[model samples]
Target: MKRVVAVFRQQKFEDVKRALLAIGCEGMTISEVKGRGRQLGVKESYRGSNYCIDLIPKTRLELIVNEDDLEDVIDTIIESARTGEIGDGKIFVSDVEEVIRIRTGERGSKAV
Candidate 1:
């Protein structure tokens, strides 16, 4: 099993969700997050004030699936999230030793 974590600009959430669902992904967890990457956020001015916003707003999605689905999932995220600009965010994949569904007490692949 594997856990896929994708962090992207908040505006891309809908498109990303649609892409994942179209590929038969059953469920995922979404979160509103603040982070900074290579672009390092941005600067904005109000009135005579100047400030640096180093923690940018972003969306985070987490899904656990069978290892075989990893590549397809990753590809789907990239295709949906790319914007030809910075702040597009990133994806991280890690092995999941086990999963247990709360309602049915299902474990392993069944849980996923």
Candidate 2:
């Protein structure tokens, strides 16, 4: 099993969610997060004053999937989240040792 963690532009959340669902992903955890990458957030001007936002708002989506579905899930997220611009965000994949359903006591891939 694997855990896919994607952090992307907030505006692209709907697109990413839809694409994931279309590909048969049944569940995921979504969060509103603040982070900075190499771009280091952004700058803005107001009333002749300039300011830097060191932490930019982003959307985070996390899901667990079988090894066979890892590539597809990553591709779907990228295709939906890409904006060809800086701050478009990133994806992280990690090994998942196990998954257990609290209610049904299901474990492993079946629980996922």
User: Largest TM-score belongs to which candidate?
Assistant: 2
Please provide, for model 2 over 42-81, each residue's C-alpha lDDT reduced to its tens digit, 9 standing for 90 to 100.
8999999999999999999999999999999999999999
Alpha carbon lDDT at 99, candidate 1:
95
Clash count, one per candidate? 0, 0
TM-score of each: 0.95, 0.97
Per-residue lDDT tens digits of candidate 1, residues 6-70?
99999999999999999999699999999999988799998989999999999999999898899
Q: What C-alpha lDDT, on a 0 to 100 scale, does residue 88 get in candidate 1?
A: 95
Instruction: Report lDDT (CA) for all predictions.
Output: 0.94, 0.95
* Top lDDT hit: 2
Candidate 2 Cα misplacement greater than 4 A, ranges: none
